[model samples]
Target: MTAALWPLQQAVYAKLTGHAPLIALVSGVYDEVPEDAAHPYVTLGSITEDVDDAHNQRGLEASVVLHVWSKYRGFKEAATILAALDTALDRQPLPVAGFKDVSVAHQQHTEVRDPDPDIRHINVSYRVWLTKS
Candidate 1:
């Protein structure tokens, strides 16, 4: 179960970064956002995984969260980015190493106004199910 997590993350990162439309909207996608990272960027958030074996096969269900940050003065920019993110990820094929029957789906998302007032945040969650290779 643990083994599949990293590969899944790598696959997700690759998908996001490799997507031209999404890359054009943000500075970058990151697992760890740098201190001086620019606005309108994406950062990988929390992930929760659980064992879900069946029929003698090892399976796992993972919840992945991604955050979109923008200081564009409104939610429009952030919302656009979120749409691109959904386009890049929702129901899309993710090629995770050492895993098969991989599937990804958009679970939900929330738009938020940061306390800073100048910032807009959107939390996007995706559900992934995979069987060990």
Candidate 2:
């Protein structure tokens, strides 16, 4: 399950960010989101198991992170990225039984870092839930 979920999260990141390098740079950003997002960054950042019970009896929990940059910082870019992510996930081909329930509990811009005082790094996090189909 961890192996499968990791790839799914990567796909989500690709769909939202549209670039590979940017995603790799700020993987830690995903940890900042409120717990409500349900592993939102799963699509973008590396996944570390927070809690897992045998046979997924208690389900799985993971953390995700993503970083982005732009001349402008606002919701337009965030919204667009999120929308694209949703579309991408919807179009994905699930396993034979498929996913029963998938939910994103939170979405927020957790941080803005300026290295040169001119360039900004935008970090976003979200929580996601996946159930059997």
For candidate 2, write residues 1-133 as lDDT tens digits.
4333655455454444554433443232242455554211322445443444447544344444555443344435444444444443333432312344444534455545466554444455555445543
Best by TM-score: 1
Candidate 2 ranges beyond 4 A from true positions: 1-5, 14-43, 52-58, 73-99
lDDT (C-alpha) at residue 53 in model 1: 90
Cα deviation in Å at residue 19, candidate 1? Answer: 0.4
Q: lDDT per residue, candidate 1, 1-133, as tens digits?
A: 5567678888999999999999999999999989998999999988789898998999999999999999998799999999999999999999899989999999999999899988999999999998999
lDDT, candidate 1, residue 10? Answer: 89
Judged by whole-model lDDT over C-alpha atoms, candidate 2 comes out at: 0.44
Give RMSD (Å) of candidate 2 vs. truth. Answer: 9.6
Per-candidate TM-scores read: 0.95, 0.47
Which portions of model 1 miss their true places by more than 4 Å? none
Best by lDDT: 1
